[model samples]
Target: MDAMEQVGARKVTFIDVLRALPKLAPDGLRMARGAVGLVTLKPTNKESIGHIFQRAAAKHPERPFLRFEDTEMSYGQANALVNQYASVYAAHGVGPGKTIAVMAGNRPETLLAALAGVKLGAAVGMINTNQRGDVLDHSVRLLDATVLVAGRDYREALNEVDTPTVLDLDTLADGATSDADPEVCATLPASTTAFYIFTSGTTGLPKASAMSHFRWLKSMSGIGGLGVRLRADDTLYCCLPLYHNNALTVSLSSVLSAGATLAIGRSFSASRFWDDVVRTRSTAFCYIGELCRYLLNQPPRPIEREHQVRVVVGNGLRPEIWAEFTERFGIDRIAEFYGASECNLAFINALNIDRTAGTCPLPFAVVEYDADTGKPLRHGDRLRKVKAGAVGLLLTKVTNRAPFDGYTDADASERKLVRGAFKADDCWFDTGDLVRMQGFKHVAFVDRLGDTFRWKGENVATTEVEGAIAEHPDVEQAVVYGVSVPGTDGKAGMAAVKLRDGTRFDGTVMGAHLANRLPSYAVPLFVRVINEVEQTSTFKSRKVDLRDEGYAAGVTDPMFVFTGGKYVTWYPDYPAEVAGGKIRA
Candidate 1:
């Protein structure tokens, strides 16, 4: 019945992008010819990300904007809805500079609300709904959130949240009108904060990173618009939680700025993912490595090779699974990228490398990292740069072009930043990730510095080991960590597993699974079977305590080990190959 809905019903054409792009980038001369197709970006000093939408809406107002199951909205309808939400926020005492926390599952409404918040010059605090206990309390408090906007289903779950005010989305949607004609006081400026994304802290408490409108807009223009080559016809499939930067900043913001359609799933469902892709006729989708592996585990289906998807973009697509995933799913491009919610540097796999985080278009350095201590090696003032091909600490220079405003918690923010990092006069942000520079600004991800350890003279990647352990059909969740062994130089890799409901797990099957994928030292020496896997607010497994528990069987519950070909509880003294010295402490 609306103008946008009518447009959604029509077939999308490539010509639409050509027409809309000129408006999106007004100075057509500014963009080099064929840059869009060649996957190269043109440099420009843009004022605001809102300019992207303003240009897009003017050019393609009627193109499909969002799709949720059978429901859909065109660009025009979405613009109007965003405006209406902006008006509502202004009416409710939420204006420029204020922080509004959004707690919900992935949905079209979540993004709509975020845009509305942005329009009001209010920063959207992406709160992980799964957070409980102290983490939940810390996230809300850190953002200095005045209002908590959440979905109806989560109202009870968030009842414990002691924020000043809470607004249920279901109630707001039912009672409020999508009327945003009035001028909103929250017109965002370049310096305006757009997002307050929380990052897991090495010091226990999470830190809230401030994302400015200028940086956000630039990301859309430089990365999403130019790098990903998003178009009006593209329907971005997002199944990750809205709380994450991967889903919020990368996927939704990029597509919305390009005036493309967005198809939001409730959550990542491996069984229904490909089916949903076909049903939505999505041209592109976002993924994390774990989500991709989950989908790959599903019985290979004919429909996978028959989908309309041409490109899939996101961070965390592992190198080992890269070729198989893309080829099997018929995806032409996998824009595998590297970034953190709180760090300055970003690496886009623009070259489409199989196992690398690709190239850093920004200024960065790889410095020497201590494999034993898992810390960056520093001398009097300067940090040592690693050899060209060795795994080292990743650092990005803080400059005007790439400013690091850091987090709301000043102390936590200051901790990771090092003054005069590369030189006595320069400053940079320590990424905490260890990467092996492959030259040409490209870096191959080795592992998370602290999470990785040397076992039997070989460095073990916890993610790689966990991936292998997860393949067992009986395993529901597997968390791998390195535990210290007496008299050894480094740690021994151990696995904490949770079995699938009602399934009896066999250790031999798990051992075979690991033996097939990992090296002898990389295989988890100790397996602790439990009923549940403890995860962080964003579903990342918490490994500090697990590592502290070490291989002491009775220290944990339901511990199991491989003996003769079957799994049996080790109790106190587990079967040990202690004599071979295969594990280092």
Candidate 2:
């Protein structure tokens, strides 16, 4: 019916577009405004993020741009601050191809300083606030930063690292002047590096992913303008860390592109999330799957459904909880998406589809892969596409339109590239994710390729198992991974679990619950009751250490073994029994 809907129908089908017609007016208008905003905000030929910010600020000087807790900053005020910080950074030779390592929490200055670096055409290395010791040091060193800017709270952590020119954020803010925008902002190109966001580093040390201004602009236009469809009056609540691409690129870009307000939270708090959402008068919010689960687990609050939030955007909203989360919270639209920090491809739920990671313009493939070897399975020198609904390795073809900028570490970037994926001389960026193709270019996220392990000759998706385990009322959290059993051909399924407050783990109840939900071999063979599961800054479970610990008898954590009928306490002889083939999965 509408022009936008007519265009969209060509891609998603006319019938689905007809189904989406009623809701298209608002979304189409918002998207139209966003498209206009994108063209006006970003320079066509050569422009930096600072230029875009300046343009937006010039247009909506009085509009509220950033809200941190009780404090709010207008577009003009935020731009002034960024200008001052940019001046300081420029004085320190932090411009054009240089790197500035920034270590801070979700404070206003964190974003201000990062934007300042952007203004000066410098790449801002956003360090995870939760990282410490070796990982922290590695992140800083990997950036090869000319200057390390740190917040007061991270002083102790900075003291441990050997970085060049560590500057206090307070001093920089106090000394800088808000007179004018940096001259370098005009000279910078869209292809210039803007920021370096670290990958999850679940396997080893995190690699710094290079984000160019071109990619940021694309994210703003594609995801913000088209996918999120936020209006200038809308306010998006963001609680995730700024270091993550979800918060930095998705949430912030969406808000900025629409000239909307971004209400920032110090960090995710299950108890105070709704209260804060209400406080900010937020019309929308961003989420990961775990954040939604945490909110669902908390006692239903009066303010939960009382907020103005109509739209929820971001990735990792699982299919199992999709209906319940949307219905219970009274959320109107869920823009579930699939992307990675380093990868170029993205799939967004543009049509408000349930339980799907939407569709993308980019060319991608779901190819058969060997779970154990972590390699794509080939048929006569050609990679094979998996049947629809079957789990497979997801790869995005590398082309001029969707180029993989990759990581700062050349070796790490090289490792992710799959040459001759479909044809000779062809290259694809391996997403390292397992997803089930649902036809119509949509996909259902299955599990991280590394997280899925083989058990009883069957591939077990940890996310699927975790989803099942989480269904149990008493289970607060579950981290599933494969653990080696001596003399066993394949790894055994192990789960490190945390129970709800004041709830004790009942082996019989849990066993029965898991048995009802999962297949015989898919059920976790061992369960370790832990106080808390270790998580990365982005709330992704850290399974490498847990996998390394294995099922050692000397381990102090309370361990249990599923004896087919019920979970039983583990003893010293359990390993021997398993190795001797006495114990069976």
Candidate 3:
């Protein structure tokens, strides 16, 4: 029996899980009692995602909405700040259809300004701070920003770039607000652009993916309400970057929609993570995989297991670590979800399943995935479907209700669309992720398709390879990717690892470990030892730069390459392999 069969039977299986969902009456009243009560059932009737602020203001105006350092803002005050910023934005000719760019870290004031911009029809283009040089220049340029608002610290980077209408957020925050009509504050339509969130650009340069108010509202209603079950008294721990959808749309909006409290942080601190949770009395938190690993690495403290945290929701938490994390941290719920900022549909952990990406109550497909190239195979007009309980490429149909609001660059946007999927003339958005259909509506996330490669006619999933490598005692973190060899069709695998402090890497031990678990081709041919891995704002490994500098000794930090069944210092002697000719590029 295969791994799927090794797993015991559950309550549901494959496509039947979709049909097995508890049916609601045609009138939809029954849904409100069970589903609605579980998740927030309210859909915003008021225009814009900021209707959340309106409702929160009305319901809990005196309640603390934002906490930053020693400063705090009530829901009423936050709404006022948003309105004030909207007025300032309108003064600067920013309204509906315009793009306002913001470059900063996570702060309540930054969020206030962003909410203010979105209150009007203007969209906020969230730029990552780590981005520099051409990529940084390209992001603001792509937004075609009417106004650029950034903190004082980023002025140097802003000076380096040429953009129209630059406003320092420090200057904006200095002025006091006068009474303003709450109703006069600009209202956004459902279809209006709310934010121009950039893609992570692991493959290439980041492109702006326009997020609509419609998508934002639906996410808050469907996933946030049903999956997370956020409550008004609950304080959300948002240490993730405001630029990330997980923090912005998922955490902040979800809280405001529920009249909940928000505990903002400048950035994630693994040491201070639990302290901050307890400090804020946070009921839930948002997380990425690395953050979880970092928390797990901390020496067990007495307070580590104690917190008000009942639920933790986010993406990229590995299935291997799922049970260990929840158990160690005393978390009651893990609402793992799978979706991309550039994609439309999302599969949320609705049933509170342990390791799976919950379920998709919408139309989706799990098609046969090509192991070598990692692309889905096309069968006539339709992509081949995966058998029950098999791993495949996850694709969501772009129906009327689940429209794909693609990126700003048309060519880049077109790359994610799978034409004629399921049926001729039908369209599906490629999630670019490998997922296992876990017997029911639940799906277990596998590795990313693009990161998987092949050697000797066998597929090697980078996540699997990395997970195996990470098991070594000396290894702290492992990032695996594929690199071209001079004379090979399939790319050879490579891994860069950060060793545990004060521990030296044992290449022999790593080699033997890999040999025991993975097929020969699945084993990494090259390894690079590093002080730390470079990650995006959301904790995803930045592989583009690493892939470019493949095994180049001095190009990156201290490095090592696997060879001769053991690891050795990477040197310039391997010219044939570096040229990509070995991989027959």
Candidate 4:
């Protein structure tokens, strides 16, 4: 079987290392220097994100740096713009110890406004452009922004919020200011705050996580220079919102680190993905797993396989489609990496491993967890490490080297800490993710802790069940969540599936396929056929509302129940009957 098709497979060999070593040798020293800087970085290191950009500009002044639609700018031109914006911001009292909240779509000015703030040693609050109403108001207030920079299109949205100061992007970019680099860029320390990226508020209100200049610099060396391994000549197509870390830190930093060109996409369009890539002549691109899945779902086109894209980099590629995506798209490499916006640790596929999140040197462990309580399991007083090839909670040790620069909310940050796990006085950052150990420091991501539910004394992974359902020809998308079952020990498995147009639900085929794919306890007991599944701006399925609704009958969507080896239409009396133990699950 192919390595990716197998569960918990560890197939990396000495020869594999030999082959990968040569590939990494070209940038090995650069990565090593970055690693050393991460360890030795101090508050007095007289380095900022702006300083790094200035360094890249000095070295490759004439190199292509930013491209959006018809406009393209060299490193020299970008630095000049950054300097001009910084000077304007400085005149408006923007300096160290202040924050500039940037809320706009994925455009050149959105990024330029942020770079300007960072240039003057001010932290840039990366507010989600998709946010509105209370959530958008909270993000700006939480950051305590000194100035709010937004696109003119967001004028109505801005009217709803009470901001300290507002600068419209369309109007702000026209002002004439000095194009000389700020001296503060040289004096600002590595510890200076750079960006305040808000977390995706899937549960409640989102919290702003601080991204320091040092952390951004580390990403340049670690995820940027090392993981993606972009060449100076490479042009990376990035469409993900600049507010998110994937685009802001991973995509942008990676491009800047390599002194390469970044072709900006206004937004992600499944129909226009290949057209945009071809138009930009991009040699690489950034992606999330869902983005890749959407591309796979699109009708096959010749331009898809006929692009200059040699390697694509990002995280969250499900294993079920790993092999298929590569073969269908003719992608030579998928530089999959695993990291969070606030987490101190990172796993990058630096060696080009198949079906793994790659390697990390920082201290971490996969330990047995108690799903009922939603926490790690402790044997007596110490948490026990699960055997290799088993799914368990991922804990990253918090140390001086791998420091947890947590959220702006100190109380929220305190809750994620797991102290005294293996040893007394030791603290670890709870990743809240379950992963399978693949041995040799490589790991396969299983599912998020919140998404895993206990059923019949076994943990059911939603992603696994959803992947199986999506394999069916009639199914367009599947979202698996835990739903309450009367008299059941734990929440029963439930799935909200969208069928392809002109296709109706086939319970027998779906039940049979799921039976062959997942264990009995893992298969969803209830399947709800809906017209659409709601998703976040980043394409992640929004399950809280669906999970809240449960197996109840809806106005538009029909519900089904699995009984006697097949799914059948659920009636109103089924809930009472199941509660009365007439029909046992």
lDDT of each: 0.67, 0.80, 0.72, 0.79
lDDT pick, better of 1 and 2? 2
> Clashing pairs in model 2?
none
- As a whole number from 0 to 100, the lDDT of residue 77 in candidate 1 is 77
- Candidate 1, residues 15-84: lDDT per residue as tens digits? 5334544343532322232234223321233234444454566588788877888888877777777676
Give each model's clash number. 3, 0, 16, 0
Better of 1 and 3 by TM-score: 3
For candidate 4, report its TM-score: 0.78
**TM-score, per-candidate, Cα-based:** 0.73, 0.77, 0.75, 0.78
lDDT of 4 by residue, 1-585 (tens): 753336534555567667878776767876776577656766568988888888898888998888898888888988888888887788788999998988788888788889989989999998866566555677778988878888877778778888978887877756747899898888998877889887632234567888888778777777876688788899999998788788889998888877899999998787899999989889999987657766776779999988989889888776767888899988888888878788887888888877788878779999999975558899999999987677789999988667787888898788789999999999999888788787777887766667667554344657767877888999999999888665333467899999999999988888887775555666788899988988888888888888888976553588888877778898777655544434434
Over 4 Å off, model 1: 1-51, 173-178, 181-187, 451-585
Report the lDDT tens digits of candidate 2 across residue range 224-332. 8878988899999999889878888999888877889999999888789999999999999998866776677667878998999988898877666778889989998
Model 3 regions more than 4 Å off: 5-46, 173-187, 451-585
RMSD of each: 13.1, 11.7, 11.6, 11.5
What is the overall TM-score of model 3 with all chains considered together? 0.75
Candidate 3 lDDT, 1-585, residue by residue in tens? 767645432234544544434431231442243344324322233457666576668677799998876677898888877777777777788877888999977788789889887777678999876565455787888999889999877888778778778887867744445425345333545767789887643344566888887778777766676667676688888898898889888887567656788889788777788888888788999977656766776678878877999888888776656778899989987878877777787778755656677777778888897765556797765588887678788898886677888988888778788887766688888887777887666787665668645443334557767777888888899998887654333457888889999998787788777766554556787887777798888888887778778865446566665666666666665535433222111
Q: Give the per-residue Cα lDDT of candidate 1 at 213.
A: 67
Q: In terms of lDDT, which candidate is stronger, 1 or 3? A: 3
